[model samples]
Target: MSLEKQLNLLKQIDNCFLALNGKKLPSPLGVLDRYLWLHEKAPYSILAQGGEEDPYFIYANNYALSCFKYSLDEILSLPAKLSAAEENRPKRKLLFDKVAREGIVYNYNGDRVDKYQNTFRINDTIVWQLEENDGEVWGQGALFWSKEKERPRLVYRI
Candidate 1:
């Protein structure tokens, strides 16, 4: 991803969070520093989906990529619904609906499946609608994390 696009994504996440939570996501002030922190240093799992009838992942930071056991390229091509198992999709849809209506939702807990089909649960997630400066709803974004020990066994690519 281009530096500009990453920076814009950070702005979107920060603005949306601040609008709802009354505080900004903490990061360094400089552009490059903030981008690096988010992608390489931040402890949270961060990701966003593109706006589509069936959305595809548009972004996933290092932590998120690791948690989902997907490479950046692999994830960007994935449908957001696949993040959860088939039986759990209905619940995922409802959560998205709530985010659409409420603009943001905090402390969301849900089960998710990784590329290896191992199931894990996410707790205290923050889900929000991604909106542009002109008020267009672009998609949705999420940020959450769990300790490695708390997550399911991961199957690493050989």
Candidate 2:
């Protein structure tokens, strides 16, 4: 994606979070600097999915890519539902429904599985609609922290 597009979407995520929680997301690099820090150096995992029936990941920061054990291209091609274990998809759907109605959901905790089938629990996640200023919903964005503190490590590159 173009840098402009990336920045716009990141801004939406930041704006939606601020609107819901009355505070910007924690970022030592500063809020407007999210486009750079979030993608390259932020500690938190960030991702966004877009589409209607079966949304696919449209964006996944390096941290998120590492957490899911997938390269950017791989993650962007998978359906968002696949992020969770098969059994957890129903619960994930319910949470998506809630976000559709509420615009944003905070403190979401869930079990997620990576491409390698390793399971991990994500706590205190923030999920929000990637809505445009005019009210068009493009997709959903999320922020989470992985247990690992190191830089993104890709298992495979394609």
Candidate 3:
């Protein structure tokens, strides 16, 4: 990643954590840049959309890109709405609006689509808005994953 992109992503992460924890946790210093690598290789996916009128992805970790079957460039080039089916977009927009007001929402459930149009459901999601020191809204991010081992989980619907 370019230094500018990396810094932008880290700023959002830092601000999100700040909002969640009531403090700022500084990024890696000197050579401890592994903090970023850890996020990239996180077990679940991490995704963020920009604050445009029609938001497109601005940040997607390696795990998210892998799960969504898109390259960094491809995912960044697409709008976040494409992740959900047409019918699901309204539901997602509602959640996005709620998060815009609530700072964060937990355990959100939703259906998502991949690059090949494969369908999947996400569970135990945590979605939140990105805010900085001056309370500027950068966008939002989500941590979630497919709710299944096979084609579909069929586990718990609640």
Best-matching candidate per TM-score: 1
lDDT of 1 by residue, 7-120 (tens): 677767767667666766555445456656777666678889987889999888888988899988899889999999999999999999999899899888889999999998
Ranking by TM-score: 1, 2, 3
Candidate 3: tens digits of C-alpha lDDT, residues 1-158: 57467556855665685577464432233435544643564456778888778999988777788778998889989989999989899999999999988888877988998999988888777788777678888888787766444232221111
Error in Å for residue 135 of model 3: 0.9
C-alpha root-mean-square deviation, each candidate? 7.0, 6.6, 6.8
Tens digit per residue, CA lDDT, model 2, 64-145: 8888999877997899999999999999999899999998888788899999889998877888887777888888889886
Q: Write down the TM-score for model 2.
A: 0.82
Better of 1 and 3 by lDDT: 1
Better of 1 and 2 by lDDT: 1
Candidate 3 global CA lDDT score: 0.74
What's the ranking of the predictions by lDDT, best on top? 1, 2, 3
- The global Cα lDDT (0 to 1) of model 2 is 0.79
Flag regions of model 3 displaced more than 4 Å: 1-4, 21-32, 147-158
Worst 10 residues of 3 by lDDT: 149-158
Per-prediction TM-score: 0.84, 0.82, 0.79
